[model samples]
Target: MTTARDREILRLAVPAFLALVAEPMFLLADAAIVGHLGTLPLAGLGIAAAVLQTVIGLCVFLAYGTTAGVARHLGAGDLRGAIAQGVDGLWLAVLIGAAVTVVGVPLAGPVVRLFGASADVADPATTYLRIALLGTTPLLLMLAATGVLRGLQDTRTPLVVAVGGNALNVVLNLLLVYPAGLGIAGSALGSVLAQVASAAAFVVVVVRAARRHGAALRPDLPGIRAASRAGAPLVVRTITLRAAILVTTYAVTVGAVADDQEVDLATHQLAMTLWTFLAFALDAIAIAAQALTGRLLGAGDVTGTRETTDRMVRWGAWSGVVTGVLLAAASPWLGRLFTGDDAVRDLLVPVLIVAALGQPVAGVVFVLDGVLIGAGDGRYLARAGLVTLVAYAPVALALAALSAGLVAIWVAFCTVFMGARLVVLVHRARGDAWLVTGVVRAPK
Candidate 1:
């Protein structure tokens, strides 16, 4: 028999999974459209996308933090407070997004240059990045708004908006890239416009909820400060995580260039893109874990929290196994969809297999990460992220230093890096430290 908890988990996870997959579809669509342009353009898109994702990834605290805060308030029977907290988070997003755009636009060229990519690759990368930075504000706005809705236990809205936005992005890219003849810049412009539309839709929905619940829509200075305070540890945590990825990317670039193997760089790009897609897909359960853990803790239901955590862990592991099997089966033909280069496609196969083998570990890490986040255990998470990064960095750098192949690089990341994360998270989850039950998390 399906218990009420199981039903709720399904209700949230199903839509959340769709929404998460849709989020990565934006990148996949971009890769597909841009790949046909030329090797240089595709390579350029890889560099630009890495920089863009890093920025967005760093700001993810807006979503995770807001989700926990809003869900806790909602569970505590304070709908108005939940909406108000979300409003403050939205305001923070606007400020942070604007600031990022102002700084990022001017540095696009220099940042891409930092990768030491050839001029042919750097030129298009700078072009795409400069245009894409214009959409940062709206992108962050969407993140904060999605957090609000998720906290309200309405993942379906995000799924609808994300799917619609992805469809629009693809259509616009097709029209602009070829028919309109804007080249790679056209792809960037299309993505920006789609993001703007999604952000607007989210804003409307969040504002309606706020008005209906009589929550003030104006920016609350103290509230914003509080949100910032709560999100500080998460920002550190995300920074460390992003740092690890950036280091891995840097390793790939350096190793490829050192070995005079340009195909390796492109192959790593494709592998990373696919890995991100899988990560988000598996994160659907994590999304459910985040919302449920926060709400359950807020209601002071300790047993329910423990039971739900265990169930979600199982769901995450099984989902990873199933996804891994499917990905491994499709690995042979997957690279052809992104690029026509035979070299890149061939190199991608083995790298992806290594990634496939790590899915179960990835699933558990993502879920436990979400569970702790939902419980507002940001401080420990922050420390753990740093520790994981510290342990993994040397091994990755050593591989790069030896000029090991791309497959070796990915093996280190998937096994050494991911394995380290799994260990720390498992240790934390096995303890009672994160089981604090109340509206506000108790200090450790």
Candidate 2:
């Protein structure tokens, strides 16, 4: 017998899951379409895609900040304030997006070269990166708008828009890339158009909601400033996390740990792929934590917020356990799906087991992360993120010297990096400092 709380969690998480899935699918579609363009274009696309993802990923705070702020106001019965904050987020997104495009377009060639791409690959990579940067505003707008909807407890709408947008992208890429003979450029154009359409759709929905609630629709400078301030720490937090992953990748590529560099690299990549997929599933619960916790705080219901936290932590733990069990059970077969090389498969098996065992910890960490974010505790999260990175560094460096092979490296990641994060997050979540009531605000 499911309780109301269970139902509420499902309501938010299920749609959020689909929405999250759609985001990666957009990139998957691009890869599939561009993969057939020959090895050079595909290679270029890989580099360009990595750069684009990192750039935009750093701005994910636009959505996270908007969601927390809007949800807080709405929970306090201040619908107008909620709508106004969302508008500010949207405005900030556009401004930042434009700035990124201006700076990135001219330096596209240099940027690709920094990644050590050869001349043959750098040209197309620069071209794709430049073109994709053109859609930055639309992409940011869509992200902020989706955050707004999530804050309003309307995940279904974003899910629908995301699905439709991806579908449109596939059709557009097929038409533009093939018949139009635009090649990789067509793939960029198709993605840009799809982003625009999705942003437009979000605008329409947000406008109607604003009108229905008698809220303001235009941008407000003060609100935008506040949103930007609130998001600054989150941005730092995100960049710090990304740095850790990149450092690990750097270690793998430089043959820092494994004797057989290529085989170890292949195994690490496969394990990371599975790990990332599991993260997507776990993040759905985190999204729920963010939305619900913010609302509870705004309503001045500290007890309710605490209850929600406990419940979410339990949910996260069980979900992680289930995911780990499944991954472990499938470990033997998982390698076959990605590779025919038995050597890679052998290296991947133990690494997958390490990842599987760490899922419960990952689940707990992610949920606490969302809880803090929704509580508008970005300052602590940012500081903690840096601290975690510092702690992980020694462990990571030891791997290079120990030369303990690929499995040992993954063990370090699971126990050291993620383990440190779990400690800080759990401490914060358990404390009352993140239980503030009233409207969510940036630190003075």
Candidate 3:
């Protein structure tokens, strides 16, 4: 009973899954390489990564917003408009990236310090942060370009670029870190170079495609402003989400300090790394949902949009079940792959089991989030995100204050935080409020 819609979902999700995992693979590799440097360095990498991820995560609207916009244009049979919208997103990425790098580089040490990491961990983190901030523009460029391709229903190019970039990153990191004696800084440098190369490849693809379709390559000021306006709510939504993660990180740090063990921090980092990888892996279906939903809605096919979304939700739930089972089964040995410290490995096992149990919830949340984003419902998402954060923050802070162990903190996150998101998303998706149809989303 394989249908056209099912085939399309598989086609997009499979490659999207591969490409999505590559980013986390970058961190996984970094953890493996840096972990041997000892707990201090691994912990340092965690802090640096949190800061970097927050910046990039906040601007993800560049990708999500652009994908929705471009897909809508393409679905309406305006290929020129699709490319034009994507071009504006690219310009915004450049401008924003430059501003972020300028401001972020100088503030790296202070930001790392704000995490209250000890001097030993803070020093290396500052070094890594300073170096990695150089790649901000390229990273944003990659995000924007990836959005364009996804909207165009071409996931294969990003898959190829991600694979090549990851390969180059591993080679450079191994050479620079061990052979050249650059330590943690070398890892950051390697990642930056890989990001730049990948960004260039994407830009080339997008530019050629634009030329072929007779779309203007230059920045369109009005279009850029419109894109910004459209993305504003998503930006707020993303901020709230990132804030939730930051709050969770802070709680973890506090709990670790209470336990008086660096292993706790290192273990939390490892768990977060695995969780991130799993999140993206599960998001493959969501990526498909975003693209297909946008296209269906744009073509004024409300029935098709509803049917596709219903199917994707079921797919997401089953995918989560399978992923959770595998992760739970792998819990014992998973830590050894990232770190050599027996303490970190021992502590990470149970924490991962707790994380594993949450995957099913995460799967549904990711899909519904994507569905809403594709339907251009950012305003509701932003408001819901704010409310969820408001509700979860106090519980997380209280747990940390009670000196709950890492396991308890994760339980609150998995059950309470994710549960809250699921409730809101399910409520939204069950309605016709987000089912508006047209090339352009009707303003809320």
TM-score, model 3 to reference: 0.98
Report the lDDT tens digits of candidate 1 across residue range 187-277: 9999999999999999999999999989999988888888888998999999888888888888888777544445776787788899999
Clashes (backbone N, CA, C under 3 Å), per candidate, total: 0, 0, 0
RMSD in Å for model 1: 1.6
Give all candidate RMSDs, comma-separated. 1.6, 3.5, 1.4
lDDT of 2 by residue, 263-311 (tens): 5655665566567668878888888888888898999999888877888
User: Candidate 1 versus the native: TM-score?
Assistant: 0.98
Model 1, residue 257: what's the lDDT? 59
Q: Write the per-residue lDDT of candidate 3 for residues 1-444, one digit (tens) a residue.
A: 338889999999999999999878888888889987788889999989888889999999999998888888888888998998899999999999999999999999999999887888899999999999999999999999999999998888999999999999999889889999999999999999999999999999999999999999888888888888899999999999888888888888876654454787889889999999999999999999889888888899999988899889999999999889999999999987878888888989889999999999999999999999988999999999999999899999998888887889899889888999999999999999999888874233
Alpha-carbon shift of residue 303 in model 3 (angstroms): 0.5
